[model samples]
Target: MPVEPDPTRRSHESWRAILDATFELLEEGGYESVTMGAIAARAGVGRQTLYRWWPSKAAVVFEVFLDKTNIGPFLAGGEDFPTQLRAFAHGFRTLYVEGPAGTRLRELTGAAQTDPDLARAMAEQWFEPRRAPVRQALQEAQKAGVVRIDIAPDTALDLVFAPMHYRLLVSGGPVDAEYVDAIVDLALAALAPGATPA
Candidate 1:
């Protein structure tokens, strides 16, 4: 009798292939060029297999972005609020502002403006997962009195991350180490207890 193969292992391999192919296409040609059929061909998987795992090309690209970046580990680094915030900010900048990933992200964001479905999928699949660790870190900071207890964790996250996004997506400013440190510093100052309006 022939030995049975592990479905779980096969599934993981297929998923990896799909993501790798998606990233390669994104790096080579941005979002508009990355079609489901191309991804399937490059990944050596069926188009149906791609559809079975994801709803659209946008979804696959966002998932690939998340997989490639792996923001969780960076957000989880360091013990204190400032340290963790710095690490997360730097990691975010590296992933979204320094390379091909940045260009792909900007392309997707532009597309999301007209495509509500893609917008929702990106928020659910990419934004939420990336935000969770930062939210948790904020909660911990609040509990430890490092961050103001008055503000919601989500708001705190916005304070910390929104400027980076604005710089990357809208302002066209440099997102270098100095900028990251300044953003983290200002955010922390605002979140500190008894902080005053500047």
Candidate 2:
């Protein structure tokens, strides 16, 4: 008798194909045009495969969006926290400045405001993971007497990241290396021990 296919492994492979196809489509033809049929065709999987996995095209696309971006790996640079934090911001700025993924990210963020599920998923998946390194760095800085003991890690992350997100989302400004350095400088000033927010 022939060996049977593992259902779990098969399912994982199918979803992976769907996400890969979704990004290809997104990169080739923006988020607005990536249909379920297009994804299925590009993925070489049946349309039912896409449906069985995701609730909607947006959901599939959003997942692909996350996979295509380096929200985590970029944040966790190395063992050292400060170097990791700077590298994280630097890497993300490079992506925002250079890749098509940035446009997709902006679209997803705007959509998240109206789509509660997308918003929640993004918070749980993309946002939190990206903040983990910053949180770790903040904790270490606090321990080292570099940052104020009173400031929470989460707050520190927000203080550092919110401006970058705001610039990316609304101002449509260029996210450059200079911008990264500035954000890091500002974050340290605000959270550093004996320093007050100006």
Candidate 3:
């Protein structure tokens, strides 16, 4: 007699197909072309399955996007704050500028413009979790007397991070390894204790 399928394995496979299909669709037609029905059909899963796991296309999209971004703590350079900043910036270069992460981010962010729910999900799910570790690292550095405590944590995050993003989305400037090191160094100088805000 034939054995029954393993429910756990089957479930995992189903979700994997769904996730893969979502990205495939994203690459093919972008955000507007993706719909729940389209994802279900492309994934070879039932519409009910999509609804069971996620409420909408954006929900599933962000969920899968989050899975792709398990890069870990942003400032994992070294024990020292300066070292950590350098390492973090280099890692950002490798992943965001050098790798495909930046493209996916540009796509998601642009799509999030019209969809409030998607924007919120992207922030609450994708952006905030990744920012948490970096934010925590900054907090620890503040306690260590490396980063100035006067600046808000979120502001500090933007100070170091915004440059890369600006280049990625707006300036179309260089985002090379040299630029990464320069930005990190600039951030360190600005955030150094007793450094006055301009």
Q: Compose the digit string of candidate 1's lDDT tens values, residues 45-71.
A: 999988876777877776776676544
Q: Which portions of model 2 miss their true places by more than 4 Å?
A: 1-17, 41-49, 69-71, 75-82
Residue 105: error of model 3 in Å?
A: 1.9
**TM-score for each prediction?**
0.74, 0.79, 0.77
lDDT of each: 0.78, 0.75, 0.77
TM-score result, candidate 3 = 0.77
Q: Residue by residue across 111-165, what tens digits does model 3's lDDT show?
A: 6888888898777766787678777788999998988999998898787779888
Q: Write one digit per residue (lDDT tens) for candidate 2, span 1-198.
A: 111225775576776777778888887889899899999998899988777767678788777776666544475544665667677778777666666766777788888888898888877877677666667776877898877988678887776677888898889786778888899887777776788655
Model 1 segments beyond 4 Å from truth? Answer: 1-23, 35-56, 66-69, 76-78
Give the C-alpha miss distance for residue 72 in model 1, angstroms. Answer: 3.3
Worst 10 residues of 2 by lDDT: 1-10
Best by lDDT: 1
Clashing pairs in 1: none
Off by over 4 Å in 3: 1-14, 26-37, 45-56
